[model samples]
Target: MREIRQPGAYSYVYGKYEEPIATVKPGETVAIYTKDAFTDQISKETDRPSQIMSNPNPQTGPIYIEGAEPGDTLVARIIEIEPTRDYAVSALIPNFGGLSNTNITRTLNEPIPEKVWIYKLEDGVLTNNKRLSFPWRPFLGTIGTAPALEAISSITPYDHGGNMDVPDVKPGNTIYLPVRVPGAYFFTGDVHGGQGQGELCGVALEISAKVTIQFDLIKNKSINWPRIESDTEYMVVGSARPMEDAARIAYAELIVWLEELGWDKWEAYQALTQIGELYVGNMVDPNYSLVAKIDKKYALID
Candidate 1:
């Protein structure tokens, strides 16, 4: 357990970066603490809009692992995500999202308000008004780490791990990230109780929360990109240009992964062609993400 003061530039959670609880053993559980996406604000029962601030996502840690090194894979298994309170708050700022660049030309569509609105899920729908529409699902807005290069990244999603707000990356899942630099400067924060795909409103149930995790070292799996495994599914994440292109890259990478894991290249290709699963992590950023997954037990293995 630790506290973070200034999360630095382009970070996800607010304030302090957290230190890993301990060297997580293969099946042991670890607990992690997190701040809200906004460093200074708290979820209050007010109807006012949050003041638009410079930084929205601040993260905790660069939790250095003792022997984590470059060319390695750090496997993180999420065990739990418990909210600190019953309900939380989130907001959408005027000029701080993927669509911000061209927002001026379409200001009317922009819903900037002096006060924020909170909606509730009414029978499988989000409704601030009893008559309006609803699209409600909840997820975290940021989960990532430092870049291999000397450069820093904003709290948004990148290969370095900032804000990759995907929906299915939740508790009881395993994440594998490539080790670019030594110790793999890892961090996490900006925990949302729930969020919909794309975070279209730019915010979710923002609040301070904690998580339990376990870490393991994948010895020689030289994967170039990130991958994840939930109890029921597997995902391969590729970040690159034009969503379709990135999606292709993601699938291609997974095929390579399957081959390297000892499948005959041709067989792996056939299997993937038959029943591989893929998803769009996010298409809003300059670099889109493609995630592919399959059940491990059923995945083609030699």
Candidate 2:
């Protein structure tokens, strides 16, 4: 059997992930065990938000894949996300999310039990709304690694990984992050039981699960940011001042990425402008996120 590594079980800061943990040629599978994104707090009965703010967003690993190098791309294909147990799902006041408008009086003070975390998002099924209740969709809130530059980033999303609370990042998804230093210093945290389009409330239906992933490398790709191929779509993750500016950075980078894939700059820009879509990944942190998606059918993957 091929050896699998745990992300939290090993030591890696910024410069350390470059060191190899285990060697794997192309097409090898490595299973990894991940701690809850909250690092171990907030379960089905525990709804206290204070505990969440205190703990760290402990990620799983920096499993050094053999042959990974700087300027390469580390493609992490999520095989499965197994939940150890159920947990509560909830939303908070506007002060908690990206759309924090002072005048908005509606706030989410209710702590939904783990069993009923999801609601029918349709039409009038819910008071004044009609929709069929749907099953809960779980995801990881924080899922990036160390920054090539100095300065410890808050557990929020940046070109480097922090608290990127995107919901589509689920099982059977593939995350592609640029290799700044060697080995790709990857980390993941803030797993959620469920979340909306934008993690507007700062947090998601937080929970922990065992994340199984397969890591592969794309050499000489020279990507400077992180991207993903979720089960349903492809996206680029970026954080910056003023949400629009951040989005610019993300899409600009995406354009460069497209160019590398053989599109001219003008064509790439036009395509992104016409068909690309944006998502508010997180707004609670100082920097905000805007993830853009380009249909996988239009792009090439090496």
Candidate 3:
């Protein structure tokens, strides 16, 4: 196993794949250390978000997988996500989040007051005000390969899987990403201690983390979008605006995936109507992400 620390191994935007800091063969495990989304600018004393750096969400790497190439699928199996800090932070930004008046959803009223809350992580739980305590469900908030043509901001989630803040991307889950460039140029960061579906508040329990992941290559297997398989379910991810469109993209991919597995298109549609589940990954980002999922037990394949 190789290790890539935060120093000198970070990207603020996803673009033409950069040179790999480290190259690894398929099935090799790499431990990556990532900084918080705020780039470690916010601390217990930090009150205003404007004090942070302009370009946030620092990702770890563009790791070059030995056999990965365009038109293939890169399988990233998350082994572990351990927080490197004792405390995590969540904030109510001035004009961000699902409920607030954001740039897209303009309003005459003033922006919401900015408030930051720091939570302590202990015994697999995050607690802030004692009245509110919840189990930690740590996950990487950003993970993606470089886009085929254009450069994308680290905050945007798209087919290339930039900042898709999906909670399902946890340990034991395998995320399949399409390779658009040679070596796949994979990168990941923005560790979240825990977050609800939709990431309603615009932020979750943000923390730096040490993440262990194993990579696998599926030669000649191409996928249109990112797909994830946990121990119990198979999911397709989609990113777009107007949330419903994201849902549509996700379901479209799921339906196609089912059909490819030997079920008739209509048959897959009907089956999905009965067993499909939709989860909102993040609504706060530039492009909202939705996940269409179904249990593996319901698979039509023998």
Candidate 2 at 120: error in angstroms?
16
How well does candidate 3 score on lDDT at residue 225? Answer: 90
Of 1 and 3, the candidate ahead on lDDT is 3
Candidate topping lDDT:
3
lDDT of 2 by residue, 178-197 (tens): 67666666666566666666
Global CA lDDT computed for model 3: 0.89
User: What is the lDDT for 222 in model 3?
Assistant: 91
Task: Arrange candidates, best TM-score first.
Answer: 3, 1, 2
The positional error of residue 94 in candidate 1, measured at the CA in angstroms, is 1.8
lDDT of 1 by residue, 76-163 (tens): 7777776654445666565544454334334546545434545443454554556544453434455554466654444446565456
Superior candidate under TM-score, 1 versus 3? 3
Which residue runs does candidate 2 get wrong by more than 4 Å? 1-26, 44-47, 51-53, 89-96, 99-134, 149-151, 230-233, 296-302
Off by over 4 Å in 1: 1-29, 40-52, 96-115, 119-140
Question: Over 4 Å off in model 3, which ranges?
Answer: none
lDDT of 3 by residue, 1-302 (tens): 67887457478888765667678789899999999988888887456776665777998877888888899999999999999988898898888888999888999889888888888899999998878677899998999998898879999999999899999889999999999999888889999999999999888989999999999999998998999999888899999988899999999899988877887889888988998999999989999999999888887566
Report the C-alpha displacement of residue 195, candidate 3, in angstroms: 0.3
